[model samples]
Target: MKLYPIEAGNFKLDGGAMFGVVPKTIWNKTNPADSNNLIDIAARCLLIEDGNRLILIDTGMGDKQSEKFFGYYSLWGDHSIEKSLARHGFSKDDITDVFMTHLHFDHCGGSIQWNKDKTGYEPAFKNAKFWTNENHWEWATKPNAREKASFLQENLLPMQESGQLHFIQNPDSDFQQSSELGFGIYYVNGHTEKMMIPYINYNGKTIAYAADLIPTAGHIPVNYVMGYDTRPLLTMPEKNKFLTDALQKDFYIVLEHDAHNQIITVEQTERGIRLKETFTCDDIF
Candidate 1:
């Protein structure tokens, strides 16, 4: 199996929102803010080439939104899914599965695109089966008032309309082997309802797709939970358990939202679990 880090694009978000109640004096040291106080955000996705299946995890926010709509997020950068795929000699059509960690726009917006006629939306990955869990599918589709803005209809529905949407059965435990994808799925609810984090066994090492649960190395501190999380209180214990397990198992964390740092490992520190080392995806495989 081969894994590729796909750079979808970059955007800026309010540092305060990203760091939640964490003081700027603390978070700014790691994730510095711009003059406007927006921090750099990456829509980093992961591509898995395992035998006949090429599975993509998280499609970054697509380019279908209006300029006014995009201005809100301050989207930046030239890196795109097409360009990133081409770098690995692959294309959208080559993707057989799109495993979404959650349905937030920055994570799964690239799942759909405007059709050629500009009449309606269509699945961006024509040949890929869009994979999401049943609980998240329902949560996103029937979003609560707080998260409604992040779950856009244009980014979803089209996958089902195109008949490429599939749901992973709820695992009986925290981690379950995904026989079809050759990885173990870890479910965490603090970030969002039933967000799936993939625990990949590759080359005698375990790589955990941190998703929003542990977005960046800076988020290694259990208290650094995102304000966007549906249940902030629940995030702490969830993160603690995951980090403890990750340290014990020596898992390489594949960061999805960290613009600069791609992967990292954590160690038990006096303060708490802290970052041990940082490296790129290629450093491992």
Candidate 2:
């Protein structure tokens, strides 16, 4: 199987919000903020070319949102899924599977787009089957007040409406050795309900698509949970356990939201699991 790190786009977000209660005095050391207190963020999506199935994990924030809506996030960059795919000699139609870790706007927004007539939205990738778990679908569709903003109806609904939406079967354990998608999936609820982290074996190395579960290497510290997480208390334990397992299993964690530090491996230290090494997709795949 071949792997590609698709640069869907880049934007800036409040460092405080990204790091949660962790004071900027601390997080700023690693994820330094700009004068406006905004830090660089990347919508680093992943593309998997396994046989004929070209699977894309997380679609990033699409360009469909209004300028006023996007201004809230400080959108910046020339990157887009279309441009990124072309960089690797592919296009939207080439994708066969879109495996979203969750339905948060930034992760799955690119899955749908404004139709040619502009009367309504439609599935962005015409040939791809959008994938998410049934539990997550329900959670996102019927979002709570705290998360309502992240789950936009225009970004969703269209995929299901297009008849191309599919769900991976839920497993008894939070961690699944292998799903029908042919990879290990680690399901966790702290970030959102039933977010799936794919443990893909590419060229004999395990690549864990650590979405919001461990957004950045800076979040390696168990308590460095994002402010956006529904259950920060639950996130602490879930993150700690995931980090411990990552060090033991030697998983190359792909940070979906980390703008600069894309992939990293963990090492057990006296302070608990910490980043052992950082790598770009080119260095690993």
Candidate 3:
């Protein structure tokens, strides 16, 4: 199997929101904020090419959103999904599967696009099957007031309407050991209703497409949960488990939202799990 880091784009998010209740003095040390208190963020999606299946982990914040909508996030950088894929000698049409970590606007927004004439939306990858769990599909489609803004209909619905949306019919448990997609899935609900984190064993090393579970390196602390999470209290225990597993198993934790750090590994320090090392996609793929 071959893997590639897909740089969808970069944007800035409020450091306060990203670190939840963590003091700016602490989080700011690791994720230094800009003059506007915004920290760097990356929509660093992952691409896995195994046999005939070319799976895209997430699409990042697509370019379809209105200017004002993007302005709210302080979008920056020239990196885009199309340009990133082309760099890997591929394109949207080459993707056979779009396995979204979740349906949040930033993660799945690139899965769709506006139709010609801007009258409606359509699946961005015409030939790819959009993947999401049944539980998350419902939660995102009928979102709660707390997360309604993140679950944009324009970023979803189009895939289902295009007859390409499919729910993984795995066992209703925390982990799906084996799935048709040729990977293991851990279903956690702390961040949202049901966020599926994919783990792929490539050459004996496990790579966790962490999504928002571990948004950035600075968020490695169990208590450094995102303020945006609907259940911040529950996120602590869930995050602790992921961090412990990464430490024990030596998993490469992919920081989907970390701007500078694409991948990382943690070590069990006296203070608890801490960033052990950082790696770029070139080092792995």
Candidate 4:
């Protein structure tokens, strides 16, 4: 099995919104904000080449939204999905599975793209079977007002329309049940709802994809929950449990939103679980 980091693109978001109640005085040190108080974030996706299956973990925000709509996020950086894939000697058609952690635009937008004449949306990975949880699908499709903007129809509906959408909830499914997942599914409802964090068994090491649960390394602080969370209170317990387990198991947490650091390890300190070390994913190899 081979895993590669795919750099889809980057975008800017309000630092305050990303860090919730965490004071700017704290988070700003690590994720320095621009004059507009926006923090640059990476839409880093993971590609897994396991035998005959080429699975892509997430798709960055695609270039289908109107300029006016994209004006809000301020997408930046030169890294693109196509360029990143080419570097790995692959293309969208080579992806057999597109495993979405959730249906948020930044995470799944690249899964679908606008047709040539702007007639309609189409699957970005023509040969990939789009994978998502049943619970998250319903939550994104009939999103509440708070999360409606993040779950755009243009980025989601096309997966099902193309007859390539599949849910991963069957008990017989071993994606999460096998030791290959490293730590297995640690589903938490605090972030959005049933956000699936993949705990990968890479060689002798254990790494976890810390989706929005811990957006950045600065967010390692227990209280730095995102305001975008549906239930911030619930996030605390979930994070505490996750951190405890991660620290106990000596796991490398792969941050999906952090621009500078790609992976982080935790340690048990007087202040509870704190970052032990930081490094790029390639350093592990």
Clash count list over all predictions: 0, 0, 0, 0
lDDT of 3 by residue, 151-208 (tens): 9998888888889999988566788864669999887888998788989999889999
For candidate 2, give the lDDT: 0.91
What TM-score would each prediction reach against the true structure? 0.98, 0.98, 0.98, 0.95
Error at 80, model 4, angstroms: 0.8
Model 2 lDDT per residue over 1-285, tens place: 999999999999889999999999999999999999999999999999989989999999998999999998898879999999999999999999999999999999999999999999999999999989999999999999999999999988999999999989878998886555788898999999999999898877899989999887788899898999999999898888788888888989999888889999999888888989999999999
Model 1 lDDT, residue 239, Cα: 95
The C-alpha stretches of model 3 lying farther than 4 A from their native spots are none
Q: Name the 10 consecutive residues with the lowest summed lDDT in model 2.
A: 175-184
Q: Residue 50 in model 1: shift from native, Å?
A: 0.5
- Cα error, residue 185 of model 4, in Å, equals 2.2
lDDT of 1 by residue, 91-210 (tens): 999999999999999999898999999999999999999999888999999999999999999898898888899989778987788866778998999988999999988889998999
Displacement of residue 205 (Cα, Å) in model 1 is: 0.8
> Candidates sorted by lDDT, descending order?
1, 2, 3, 4
lDDT of 4 by residue, 1-285 (tens): 777889989889999999988889988998899999999899888887888888888898988888998899888879888999999899999999888888898999999998889899899999988988788899999999999989999888889989999987643332355332223666788989888888877788877888888988988878889989999999988888889889889988888899889989999888878889998978864
Query: Which 10-residue window of candidate 4 scores lowest in summed lDDT?
Result: 174-183
